[model samples]
Target: METIFGLDLPTWWFLVVGGVFTGYAILDGFDLGAGALHLFFKKEESRRIALNAIGPVWDGNEVWLVIGGGALFAGFPVVYATVFSAFYELFMLFLVLLIFRAISIEFRSKEPMAWWRQLWDVSYSVSSIMLALSLGLVLGNIIQGLPIDDQFIYRGTVGDFFNPFSILMAITTLSLFMMHGAIYLVMKTENRLYAKLTVLVKNTTIFFVLMFALSTVYTLLYLPHMVERFKEVPMMFFFPVLTILAVANITRQITKRKYRFAFFSSAFVTAMLMALVAVGLFPNIVLSTIDPQFHIDIHNGSSTDKSLKIMLTFAVIGVPLVGLYTGFVFWTFRGKVKLDETSY
Candidate 1:
């Protein structure tokens, strides 16, 4: 096993893949959240404003998903193949929804007719909600362990993915994204919409907090293995503590009308939550419910050392470029969204 800075190649690749997905969650989360709340804005102008708030960067944010998929396939082809095979229908539905979401965003403002716009609005909101829920369902199953046999083949049916824990995780994911999106909208609007979002932000915050609490309790009680790593390494407790503080600070910053800070807090919460998941699933990319010997770990799931080394070189150069481009886009579009003739 080739080591870089003491950690093995697969572990480095694990962090890289995890980091890319975390970026996707933080970047695209707000826009999806905004889309989920679209129907709540009854007025056409309000809907347009909400859409325009995310208009400039929504597609750019999705680039992270592409990067994540590529990284997953590059680093852990076995896990990718098995997981995708296991969730084939769900992933296909997710892809269809993503396409519908992109189409709704692009076609929503093309016509002046109320029926046309209303149709796309419903499509957009429903797709966003489903996208978030689907992501949660996948994450939940991953954490709960899949029924993988010794050959790394998933033995579970599609129906098996819809357990109560996955459903709870799905809703919790939606609530967190809603909170994140509401804060972003609050930061990007003025006057009426801002005021409306202030009220909505509080509600979303409450919604996320309640859901998070329930998820934590459920994990502690039923999913004991998820917390085993933290118990083994007490210092890893800091991540969860920081996650709690970040969640707490979101409401604090919102109450103080520091929306920029609140938005940052929300992003931090997303990152921390993903980090917690990574920590819990360390070494094992996919756990097996069938038997302990069936786990697909970083070592067994990864590519050759030489391949990882070559890809790491590319990733080192390429990831920074992507980050720079993302930063530039946000910096260029940094301000309250003003509706113009060109607005979405």
Candidate 2:
């Protein structure tokens, strides 16, 4: 791979993939979060409003996931191949839930029957929560290190993915998404539903903070190597500082009833957290629990420089266009949701 200012093309591709994933978390996160909180809205109108809140852009937001996955595969086929082979069942489950979530929204309002709506509502919320948990579980396992051999094959059973720290992270991810969704709902609702979401935002914020704190403590106490870079470079402290500031801004904006600012802060928090993860796991695409030398990183895992360069060209052009489309969708639907015959 070509090098730019000491960093190779593979490393640059890694950053691009990470950035794309961060975009996914920030965009689709509120979509999942809103679904996760579906049961909280008991009234029929409240649920519809919540569903419609994400109706315009949910599918578009998921494009980032596709792009991120593609970038990973194109840039580092080894990581993609190894991860997919290892997490086949988990990914299958994710796909099932993903389908359920979509239908739950479209089918919910199709029939006026109570049981029918109830079924879809439950499906939507449960599927959303499961999706969030799955993402967190994958992240936790990646951070904790995986049981991969020198041949880049996973040795551990699927059951081993659910360690204590990973489980906690799954919960933390759920809480974070809940908080993000609540903040979004607060922006897209009014009257009783808006008022209810106001309270939810506060509580979810607290929940996320508590969970994040506990996860941090666990990582610090048990997974010392995770923070090795932080200790080695005093300047790496900025990421944590940025996270704290962004979280504090979330609270500040929420307290002031500035939904837009609060929403941006929530996005910022996601970006900062994901950035830290990327920085912490730099070079190493997947950490090896069995042996350090078995670790999969950019150099050993990446495609040829020719392929990376071509993909980089596509990415450079594609990312901004997607961003523009997303921004345009948000701009089009930039207000509290009102139920019309057209609304889902």
- The most accurate candidate by lDDT is 1
Scored by Cα lDDT, where does model 1 land? 0.94
Colliding pairs, model 2:
none
lDDT of each: 0.94, 0.93
Q: With candidate 1 superimposed using the best TM-score fit, by how many Å does residue 220's alpha carbon deviate from the native?
A: 0.5
Clashing pairs in 1: none
All candidates' TM-scores? 0.99, 0.98
Query: Which residue ranges in model 2 land beyond 4 Å of their true spot?
Result: none
lDDT string for model 2 (1-344, tens) is 46877988998999899999999999999999999999999999899999999999999999999999999999999999999988889999999999999899889989999999999999999999999999999999988999999999999999999899999999999998999999998999999998999999999999999998999899889987778888788899999999999999999999999988999999999999898888788768899999999999988999999999899999999999999999999999998898999998
Total residue pair clashes for candidate 2: 0
Worst 10 residues of 1 by lDDT: 276-285
Global fold similarity of model 2 (TM-score): 0.98
